[model samples]
Target: MMKSKSKILVLDDDPNIVEVIVTRLESMDFNVHGFTDPGKALDALRKDSYCVLVTDQKMPEMDGMVVLREAKKIDPDVEVIILTAYGSIEGAVRAIKEGAYDYISKPFEPLELVTKIEKAIEKRELKQRVRFLEQEVGDSIEYRIYAESPAMKRTLAIARQVSDSDSTVLIQGESGTGKELIARMIHYESRRKRRKFVVMDCGATPPSLIESELFGYVRGAFTGAIKDKRGIIEEADMGTLFLDEIGNISPEMQTRLLRVLESGEFRRVGELKPKQVDIRVLAATNADLEAKVEDGSFRPDLYYRLKVISIKLPSLRERKEDIPGLVQIFLSEFSRKTGKKIMGIDKRAMNMLFNHQWPGNVRELKNIIESAVVLCKGTTIGPDEILLSGIREQKEENLNTLESQEKNLVIQALKKANWVQKDAAAILGISRRVINYKIKKYNIRPEKVN
Candidate 1:
């Protein structure tokens, strides 16, 4: 087992320059490998992973552009910086079009060269971090199941175990449950990680274009077909395809999709010979697909085919135990993003979050946190920061029944305690448990107390 190092392969015909570059890069704490021959450099690239390739544009056998093109073929993500003479600026521009990161003109200051190298490396590191994070998020099969509930934990475990296989997946969940995230996770974790992951929202897109988009169309296939285009199935060949809200797709499109899944062969809009592709289908639905099949709205065979490995995401209310954690997570994330220094939510604000029936599920909770983060002023998020319309509307309706003086006193207590019953009880010189029973009887939301 060979250890990995941050190696930079320096390919320049000039021996003195290579030596100078190598010595400087080594001093900057980089592992340097120099090559005069372009052929040998290509071979080294194949044998090892180099963080960046610094090559002169004018070489003996192959030029820098040619080398860069070949290097990209080996590893498309490897950053390439071209060294061009002062006269070859036009050529450098063309090289950049072919995917060179940047070009340095000859007769440049040594400090300027070092600065360019530093910037290039920094950019590469940032790209690498984003890629790793995206992969981690995409690879986690349980991301859709955000709760820490035992049922969700078990569901995630099953998803992880089955992600390596090429089996079809059927994701069942209510509206706003993240069924699509689970499908993305399976695709990212599977053998087809490098290929395309296409998503088709069966309910959103019109039925007329669904078939063409899924299968693809050739030049002159229709009035708008000016060029040959690969269908989504072909685009997703050797990868995964996510069909969202599958129950809403038309019967014709469903039949076409079923045929492709069954035979791994389908024709383009105007093409005769059937094209074959290796694609994994991941289908999701908020509707009861089995009921739809029974009622003749969905195909029975397709339903069974997609349900080879089934998983369902639970609603947020059913997993109320995880609400505090979820709320804290959302607050931190939103605060950081919005540049707010909100330390934590007040006790009253916390009560309102937990007691409210989250009809919109986790998505609603996240939005609420984001909105609060935007409006919050100081370090701590107080009850006044929660501006939920439902809570405000209910509070306004109840305000008219009480005398102005009495209402003011109750509002003062609620606001002072930040909505927690025990704290409010202490302020009013009452027992904690009695305050709790009163909270229930009065239907007073913590955020609504003021």
Candidate 2:
């Protein structure tokens, strides 16, 4: 039996031909509708959702071209197959040029007709599946992270655990470390998943307008304020508001934000009455808030409030083990988008990726892979195609400076304490735990280094 829920509309103008086609289709367990008049067939198409339309080329009221065009108007996706007794090249070409799926000769076998119908239905179903997959992948945030390293795993685990709460979360990480992506993951996995997730870049917005953007203004509150507007916080009511680069906001703005976090109430500009909302705030920053607080720039109280639940993200260099997996994800995405058959990266290219320090983190790696995929002509990506012109030199300089500073500190501490772990920890004014962590982090083998 045919597994499809498809109904075939057969319009041949002759009752005998229509009967034969309908009987054959029904024998194969297909739902078949027969029509003798082209006008009646077109009217039926408008009323019902038929999968395939088999219409005779020559008719009294209208030709196959008219039926095809009218049927397409009713359902653009409907597959229309033209049946012509003359089988003339001009007629076949015209039928096809006018949007007919395929032209079938009148003397064709029943099996041949069935084959064409089956192929047409399969094509439509394939297209529908592709659209669905695209939407699913586009909307999924889990696919965006694409992590394999333990550091990333730990970060994701923390995000998931805190998603159920409404407490303000502070995410501290370097630029392009997927801070926004993690913010989205938290929103999508939360109880308020169905609500809006609004993002505001505190650093990008001008100081003059940042307040108005967060707590909107009323009509005539200021120049160009013709109408009352809703701020991002209000828009994110019963949802999540992600404030990126939170450290860049002014001290006054920080105080305002503190009030909102404490009471969930804020008034629109020029409004006396306070408006209440149920919003979850997730703030991200790359700056050292402790240092900022000490310098009397960021409010210490606000900093403490924001850090109630803090998650520090590991940079790409710290989690280099995840690079191969991330590269694969980007390759698959770009290959699907560009209709390319790029299978994987060569060892030389992969090694180059692993060696390079990604200061911009995952975002930089993704951009590099995208550029390579676009420029590559072959199936696999090679080192020659991968461009790292300006980034490589800067990364090398930064890496050298960081390593030299770390090596000097470790060497000095070891020398001052005569290579004793406890003495070294005491001299550095750090705990034994921290000394061990740094030793591993910097790959400091003091005995072999000297």
Per lDDT, the best of the predicted structures is 2
lDDT tens digits by residue: candidate 2, 1-450: 133457799998789999999999999988889999887787677544577999888888788888888898877778998898864757877878878889888788999999999988876656654654464347563347876889999999999999998888999997668888888888879987766678898866778989999998777889999856778887677678999989989999999899999999988887788877789999999888999999999999999898889999999999999999898988988888799999999998888888876655776677678778887899999887775212232345545654554445555566656778776666444457656766787777756677
Quantify all predictions' global Cα lDDT against the true fold: 0.74, 0.80
Off by over 4 Å in 2: 1-143, 388-450
Clashing pairs in 1: 215-231, 216-231, 348-418
Cα lDDT for residue 431, candidate 1: 55
Least accurate stretch of 10 residues (summed lDDT) in model 2? 387-396
Assess candidate 2 and give its lDDT.
Answer: 0.80
